[model samples]
Target: MSILIDSAVVLKSYNNNIVSVTINEEERILFAKGIGFGKKFGDKIEKGTEVEKIFILEDEDNLRNFKQVIENVDENFLILCETMISYIENELKEDLDERIHVALVDHLNFAVQRLSNNEEIENPFLMEIKALYEKEYTLAEKVAETLQYEKGVNIPVGEIGFIALHIHSARNCGKLSNTLKSTHLINSIVEYVEKQIEVQIDKTSLDYARFVTHLRFAIKRILSDISIKNDFIKEIKSKYKLSYKIASGVSKILIEQLQKNVTVDEIAYLAMHIERLRIATIDK
Candidate 1:
């Protein structure tokens, strides 16, 4: 589906494939397998060209940020980001939000640059990310593998988690802030549990993974207004007194954030998970 541009002058070319061209007074991007090959600034794109995609950035801020990113980042890497986005769309069979171009390319460029310099990348929520976003994580793993084999950059599991989050965000047009809030809320709850129990958790342990996974779903349920009946809430609360106490504190946090009551059943379920975590720590 090619939209004929009345007049297009190439303003910039990226990797002999994508060109930022001025169509009339507006900036329109022309991209295809080889649309920009042998092209230069002031060069006019020919009519009826078999361009694969045209990106019209409607938002001024997004357009400016994207142009800035391309200007400062390496052209070859910018093309790589285009390729990655194409690959992601192919895998998902859906068009992603255009904003991903600015966010993802910049993130990957920084990750690769810093990784080349041996900076330690940490993603404490990697396990939670994998569990919550299973499909996105799989796609991210393939992307990481491609980078390792083709680009010789072995993106760590943590980086893959970040990539998965980006892919998920793009696919659903989800805000990164909301995702970060969920992650932060989960981490805070974990920290609160550890503090209440007075124990330093082994983050690499299965117990920690399970705890995080449960917290992720619990937060999702809370935000989505989903709940389950827990006839055993009172019994569980009585049996796991310490865990119940920690869960009560967690409930307060949830209530403050949500501005509503987190059901007793949900709190009891959290108490059960907390008890399991405490038991595992004591046994270790």
Candidate 2:
């Protein structure tokens, strides 16, 4: 019942517990306690040997994370980690970043252990996670359900949000550490503007789509220390006072949540987009 295909030759031993292997001439790192014990360079890993896990490190970052996991976690945990990842990849038909092998595995191992010990943690961003990441949340629920059925562990509902976060991070190449915060910030700003203008936004509208796109990049820029300068900041502030005021409120939320300063140019641009969206909503 071994699921592995394509026999691989051991290339090098990272340690007594981990080995680098090449399958079909393509290199991958394998982790199995005692798999590398007494194994030498260029040794062909025996077929049907139970490897705790194998990782295809596509880049240096992935390799680093894989090494960290191998160094820190036990072999049994890695097995569960690999199984969950394989299930998700096969079910979703998406290639997640290799980092999920480390992050999600670590989270689930700890979460399951804690729940077994009658300790539970609450997810503060659960509502936003459910709202913004519906697909990932659904997948997370299925993951929880599978674990409960197979492992006899009843993972808490709150863990679904945390799992959804990991799924989202993996799907987006691990750039969504603050995704829930970013989502909440965007929704709050949109809601604030809509209430101020006494209009409900059409989420299906192109203008709303454009506004969301703008906010998404704006959040990225703030996180990445990138800023834009608007030469007409004064003009924009004067011309769109109502929009500017709403944007200022959003700027405050960004500052509070991200602890990053938002430039007047960023505020002005947000205001301009908000004004456009407001106008569009009114016309509709």
Candidate closest to the true structure, highest lDDT: 1
lDDT tens string, model 2, 140-259? 998898778866888887898778878876787534556566667888878887888899988644456457656766786677566465677899899999989989988998888789
Task: Name the lDDT value of residue 280 in candidate 1.
Answer: 94
The global Cα lDDT (0 to 1) of model 1 is 0.78
- lDDT, candidate 2, at 33: 66
Candidate 1 per-residue lDDT, tens place, 1-284, comes to 47554868898887576788887778988767777788888998866677767888876656766777777788767777778888899988888877678777877887888777889567756777788789999988987887777668778999998788778767754456766787688788888888898999876454565576566656765765655557788799779998998998999999998776798888998999999999999899
lDDT values for all models? 0.78, 0.75
**Residue-level lDDT for 13 in candidate 2:** 78
**How do the predictions measure up, each by TM-score?**
0.57, 0.52
Q: Which candidate gets the maximum TM-score versus the true structure?
A: 1
Pairs in steric clash, model 2: none
Q: What lDDT does candidate 1 reach at residue 269?
A: 85
